[model samples]
Target: MFTINNLLDIMVLVIFMNMQEKLTILADSAKYDASCSSSGSALKRHGDIGNTAYSGICHSFASDGRCISLLKILMTNCCIFDCKYCLNRKSNNIKRALFTPEEICEITINFYRRNYIEGLFLSSGIIKSPDYTMNLMIETISLLRHKYKFGGYIHAKAIPGASTYLLNKLGNLVDRLSANIELPTENGLKLLAPNKDTNKITKIMEYIKENKSQTFVPAGQSTQMIIGATKETDYEIMKRSSEMYHNYSLKRVFYSAYIPVNKDNLLPSLNLPPLKRENRLYQADWLMRFYHFKVNDLLNADNPNFNLLLDPKADWALRHLEEFPKEINTCSYNDLLKIPGIGVTSAKRIISSRKYFKISFNDLQKMGIVLKRAKYFIVCDGKYFVNNLCFNRSFIESNLVLEDNLLTSLKGEQLSLF
Candidate 1:
């Protein structure tokens, strides 16, 4: 039964099984990564095989939360670093796969034509060394751009230890570049992803901003920070966000709520990631960029985080209640923005409509501004229209929560729709 030919036959079967297993493992592992979308650079075909569109396509998501489009597979699943949260961590006892640059290009081209995906995502697990892996990633982009003339949307991951030259070159070809901050703080990185250098990662982000101006990467750069994995306060996160926006001119900083994939003793064992915290951070970020609220105004040493119950802006208003009860008819647009229920859109509507005639409480209701919270903060035509009995802003804010649901449901109704 143990003949030489029989042994060779078993070995051949084993190799085939291993290859099949590797593909399944790597693709399944990649499903959890949600860093999708193409919005940075625009590449023209110039009589080449393919072309890039400004609005890139994202197909769908599996249960694990990865956006499924563009053949979202890693170049290799064999990592050198032992990031505890990563599925492909060096200590992971799982099947691994590595694709040659040509193989990846062939797959992308075929997939694009069949309408399976618009392009390629092409991330890796730090095979061999960071510098070497970075080169391979660049080489893959080079092959796709130069040899294949692939003008489709290509989103490439900037390898951690990759040189500036490699990043700048890769930036030229790909539509978007993301250098994941992984963890929020240096201590978090030290505990969760020991090998990662926080300083080096930040430097790469700055370099991306510096170079992307004159050449490609018009969409600018975006990075991801894992939340709830470490003890980093939301204040700390926003502080870094402030610097990142000011110094590097980053387009977005995404937050991936940390779901413990591995059962490490050091990690939390929550059934779901801190989605609420993630939502609040996005809200705060919107305020910073659009609402003209500074990070310092939102948090301080004593209050180094956001309130889970109330939004950041509402909470800020509660602490400083004396500024409320302003005249709605005469209040300027900038002043209207500070009112609890009135947003930029509503404030502009008030300013435009009131110029024709003085605005009353009835008129504000017709303009579609939420009045429950605005009542405590605004006066209509020299009349105290609302109860105003409860001076506490929190009581008014609590009642305002129902408006979002009511408005959302009324969107398709005949009264609102047509």
Candidate 2:
């Protein structure tokens, strides 16, 4: 009773359903990677489909304070390695899917045309071999670039053991590239992810570092470390980050709070992910990157973990209170940044405004400084903002804690309709 047209319609429907299933599986599998944020690419071409000039193209934010929008998905969830931490490890019995180069292009083009996404964040689990997997990725992105002329941002993950030739080819085609470090220490890698070689990962980073030109990976590279998966402390993690930034010239180092995806004796049996620890690490990382703080300045063997009650900058200020009460009118720009409430922008405003006239406490407020914290640490026009302010550590700490709790309580309260 079925005609040729009806048969064709049924076949098309089946194909669409199959692709939808693949999209669901691959996208869900890709959620764990935190290094997918895009930025620093300015590639534009004449008569191209899209460009990366404005900011970045991903679902999350870039380090430059821009919201990046993209379709973040994995090329495939199939794997050849058996890492204990990975959900898609070959030993785990999970529904697997793979997308051909043509299918990937079709999805990307269709999605971009519909304004569903701005770009693509492509990653993969090892399929057959590292080189084989990387080659497939390169072909998919290459097809997007040449055939579709898609000039939008593309962030690709570099396979750990892929050859230099493939790496070079992939780097030239994508805006940003990342090779995840996975763990802070080589010992942790050996314990949790035996198949993943820390040496191979760093070698990939080194390759990118040495070969990066203006045209190749113009957005630069980033790496991610899984926190709380191993016993390594925050100090150890920061030290590794400092090393990567200095040695590899990385754009950013992302911190992922480990979620228990697989059950193994080697892994921690946590009821929930250590999200608070991750936030603290990010705060410490910001201080290191922007405020010119070293790992030793924040922590050492004596105090290896961040304080749960206070942020890294505030905690440091409390310990080093002798350096505080900085004069707003005369202090250096860097010194202004050391104040808890003064950010980079506010500090710049203070410097620029004070040149014209002496900055008062009201001017500090006008400059967008959080006087609640800065009041205890800074003075303006040779006068304390809070008269007879006690510089005692315990007194200042108790007040700061009370203010933080009040703010948190206010944030949690529901609005009343009068």
Candidate 3:
């Protein structure tokens, strides 16, 4: 004996409960993956509600210590692949749900209209198979692009085993695409995520690179590697990254510091919060991409890993003290690149500006080279800046330290937001 009003109320309550459940499962599952750069778009519809900013945005951080935005969710949480570290592994007992392509489109538009998000970031646990799962994601984007004509940003994961045709179809529809390089090496993949073939991931990245010239993946393809989970050394990671960049012509390679989400006897018992390792890798990555640093030039067997205390640039400067006092006027771009505080941007500015006038030490500072770190590395004419340190390489290395905890500063002080 229920009236229409009672039926409507019941439907509302059920929908609310379903949303709560979906939110918990999705946000929890997405905590591990950190390739969240949303900067690969050239499309601009005049008077459009959403605009893709190259600088990107950090909407918020979840409790598991990852940023959240764009209604980040999995179309389905029912994963078939059993990745040892993942909570959504096929064997794990977790509540799961699947959203239809239309469901996702509806949710995205509703969220956007309500000012809940800028767009959609859709990732999924492999349901049935990688190809099937990939197709579902593709359909979601297609619906958004063709039917809804959603000009808003869409970040979609290129499932490792997904077909090139599917990926190419996706390239035209979505803003940015990614194929997760979950681990540093094939051995790491074999151990942690056995079902995910490393070769397939590499092949997909290769395809993206080949097609980028003609069709283009606007934001370009990006990949993520989980650090500290496997035994892969930092040297090994950087070497692989260098190859990926050269071969794939990738826009970026992200490093996700390993946080042990599930209990496994094989995994480390010690909770190694990944922020420090993550930050150092980012600095090293910057050196590779912009500063023209080779992996071998930056790290090797003796220093198999980045120093947790100091940044890669500072660490490199401290180690190579003999190369210091590089003459500003005389040094080539290659030599300027070797200077600690001088990044690619500063080096170019200094080189370009010097042609007009003889740039002095003060002028070098004005050009954007961080004098604090650069002072010891470069000399203006005959004078040294940071060479005041009396210690040797190892001694200097021990002193140039950074803070351990980033989340505290990022969260409490809101430093990360800026």
Candidate 4:
């Protein structure tokens, strides 16, 4: 026989417990999404609470090189589908939590004022159905914008198999959106995450494309594929990524190292995450996106995987020795980009500065080119810089050197948020 006052007291306790308990559980649950980076949004919403710029979001890098300061968390950790590799899969015995739409709005506003976060990166487990989960997230973002006037950046992941209408609604509100192609191929999804497929995932992207002509997803869409999860080759993954850029107009493709979170017969027992492979893939992606390199330019049947010892660009240069020792004086801008160690800024500097004065080896170093790496690939005016170094064989060990002046490079300065 509980009194009305007793019932109220019990309800109050449950609510308090939910706030702290759920925040921890849901935040930890959302950590698996590496595509939550909030950048490249040129949106300016009038009278909004937060603002999104190229680097307006804080660029606080983690010790592991991950950026932070976004209030990234899941709406719920209770899923209907059981993906074996997932820590929060239905079969896994774990603490579950849910954040109401109002609570998400409250947290974002409070965190913004306290300077604890610059924006929100919201994701969720498939609770009840994809529609239910996506709508809940959409509701959360709507409250942040309309009710709280939160003008801050928002990057949300679209749930696979979610309704097209719900998907369209979501694109209108957030600064950026992503649909995680968790596994590299359809076969990998069928074996592990049996319920999900690329077909359903691509439908959302297709819808976005149809709607993109309007103001939908103004910051553009991006995606992530978990590397080392399946038997898919680097060539296959890169081919798919290139197709996405040309086919769906994707802004970026993120590669996540497969960190084993659960034990399964389907998964390999690894000592550590394949971070080196992951880094190489990102460098390859950069070549495609920024360096004007094509998929075929980086890979073929003979060289399916990128060399772990050297970067993708340097590796390509080493393989094609005949192309090296490029005379910088007469090379076109496009050809300059092909040289190893030369980036967009350095290539531009060569073109621009050469018009005024003849480019030299020392001048290149001042222009932010890594002389140690570039010297092996370029001939300055008529004289070769590293002419003595043999390129007939792999110079991987001797040629290996890091460019410390990345921040001073023309491209580097352009990327700085502040």
Choose the strongest candidate by TM-score.
2
Q: Which tens-of-lDDT digit does each residue in 32-67 have in candidate 3?
A: 667666665666633235666666666776665456
The TM-score measured for candidate 3 stands at: 0.84
TM-score rank, highest first? 2, 4, 3, 1
Looking at model 2, the pairs that clash are 58-68, 58-69, 58-70
Identify the runs in model 4 with alpha carbons over 4 angstroms from their true place. 1-18, 386-391, 394-397, 401-418
Please give the lDDT score for candidate 1.
0.75
RMSD of 4: 5.7
List candidate 3 segments past 4 Å from native.
1-17, 43-51, 54-69, 113-116, 213-216, 356-358, 363-369, 386-418
Best by lDDT: 2
TM-score of each: 0.81, 0.91, 0.84, 0.89
lDDT (C-alpha, whole model) for all candidates: 0.75, 0.84, 0.74, 0.78
- How many clashes does the backbone of model 3 have? 3
Residue pairs in clash, model 3: 40-219, 375-386, 376-386
What TM-score, to 2 decimals, does candidate 1 have? Answer: 0.81
Predicted candidate 1, C-alpha RMSD: 6.2
Reference-based lDDT, residue 398, model 3: 42
The sequence of per-residue lDDT tens digits that candidate 2 reaches over residues 1-418 is 2111223543453366588798988988987887545568876644257777555544545443334476788888878788999988878887777788898998988888776677899999887789988999999999999998898878899999999999999999998888999999999999988899899999999999998887898889999999999999999999999999999999999898899999999999999778768888988888989999999999999999999778789899999999978999999999999999778988888888888988888877777777878888887777876664577788889988888778768887322111
Off by over 4 Å in 2: 1-17, 57-68, 413-418
